[model samples]
Target: MSKILLVEARLHLRDGASLLFTIALPLMLLVFLGRAAGPAFPALMVMLSVLTLSFTVLPTVLATYRHQGVLRRMSTTPVSPLRVLAVQLLINLVVAVVSTGLLMAFGPGLPRNLPGFLLVFVLGTAALMAMGLVIAALAPNGKAAPTIGSAVMFPLMFVSGMWVPREYLPEVVRVIGDYSVAGPFARALGDTWVGQAPHLPHLLVLAVGLVVSGALAVRVFRWE
Candidate 1:
């Protein structure tokens, strides 16, 4: 696992887009939003941004690997599909944690509760990764993954009050946002970063999402 992750990380850092999205874009978001939304909200945005990073980027990268026949090629060896997926996921999770820490150290932030924060972080990352893999499974080519990823990510980011606060969006969009990935995840981040209680319902929604998405992702994912 460690070896796989190290190799994947090296490959990831070499890709300009992936590296920027993984490291720069989120930090930029944290800086801009943190300034605009005030400390409390910007702090939360860090986690929110990290969640988006995990779901959107990891799948795209994996899809690229699939397109290049890396995944298909892997099947001829002893490595399990599960292990490959696990390594990529662990790498993404590490990126998320590191990004969150950077925000705490440098970016503006609200309060934080470590225990609840970690619970939300762990579950939220898993749910998003499941969804990401499902996207990767559904999209055949690496080139297509971004389209799929954006389709999944933008709405969640938009509606989740990342761009416009839920209070600002039209009621219809607001309602939709509530159910969107960003919506629930943002709410969960609020609880985590601010030392508030987890919204059990929102967290459950995340769990259900991971289950459904993970199950489907497994069914559809192909080595080739």
Candidate 2:
């Protein structure tokens, strides 16, 4: 497992474009939108980073591996192909932590409710990644994975107030956003950032998303 992790890490590092986009894009956006977003800026930036990893990077890598027969071949070895999926998840999590660390070091401000922030962060990230796993499981091939993920990601981002503030969105859209994974994640993190406990409904939405998406991914995922 350790060897697989090391090899996978090295392979991931070779994808220079992905690394740059995942780490640099959010910081660059912060530079332009920091003052405008005010207190919500850091949370928005962190959410963007997390969403990018969960929707774009993760599914693409896993689907590509399966499409290339990598996962299929792994079945012949001592290691289970599932370990590769786990490693990929771990690597993406590390990237997310680094991105968040950078935001803390250089962004507008840190979350005031540290414990609550961590709790929301964990649940939100897990839920989002579980959805990504479902994308990886269902996508027909590498070429289709990013297409499917982006289709799902963009609408969620829109409703989550990535482009427009939730206060500005229509009441119907806001209600739907409350139930979406990204929406709850954004709201929960924003609440925690301002030193408030996350709303109970937002936590429940995230937990439910994690369970449903995780079970679906495990049930439908194929080595090939």
Candidate 3:
């Protein structure tokens, strides 16, 4: 597994688009938004980092391997295809964590409730990764994964106040954002960053997403 992880890490670095989305874009957003909106911006950028890995990077890699018969070949070997997927998820999780660290180091304020923030961050990252796995499981090929992921990603971003602030959104939109995974995840993170206990409802929503999506992904996953 460690060897597989190292190989995946090399492949990830070789893929310029993957590097850009997973690392460069999030850091850029942190600098730009952190300057404009203060600590809230870094919190949101953290969410964006998770989304980039979950929606774009994870799905693409898994689908591509499946499309190329990589997963099928692995099934006949000592290396399990499931291990490959696990390694990919682990790599992306590292990227998200490192991105968050960069924000904390350079951004103005630190998360006041460190334990609470970590709780939200871990759960939120798992939920999003589960969602990404579902996409990887369902997409017929590499080309289709991005399309499906984008369809899901845009609505999530919009409802999460990526486009418009939740406070300024219409009542209906705000209500949707309240329930959407991204919205609650971002809110919980921001609240904890300011030393507040995260709202229970938000935590529950993310937990549910993690379980449901993970189950579906496992149930429907294919090697090729």
TM-score against truth, every candidate = 0.90, 0.97, 0.96
- lDDT for every model? 0.74, 0.90, 0.88
lDDT of 2 at 189: 92
Worst lDDT run of 10 residues, candidate 3, spans 31-40
Looking at model 2, residue 187 earns an lDDT score of 89
lDDT of 3 at 77: 99
Tens-digit per-residue lDDT, 1-224, candidate 2: 89989998998899887777778888888777787777867888889889888988999999999999999998899888989999999999999989888887787667999899999999999999999999998888888998999999999999999889899999999989989999999989988988999999999999999999999989999889
In model 3, pairs of residues that clash are: none
| Residue-by-residue lDDT tens digits, candidate 1, 27-131 | 777767666665457545555556556556777778888889887788787876667888888877777778777777667443467788778777777888888
Best of the candidates, TM-score: 2
Q: Which pairs of residues collide in candidate 2?
A: none
| Candidate ranking (lDDT, best to worst) | 2, 3, 1
For residues 173-214, write the lDDT of model 3, one tens digit per residue.
888888788899989988898789999999999999999999
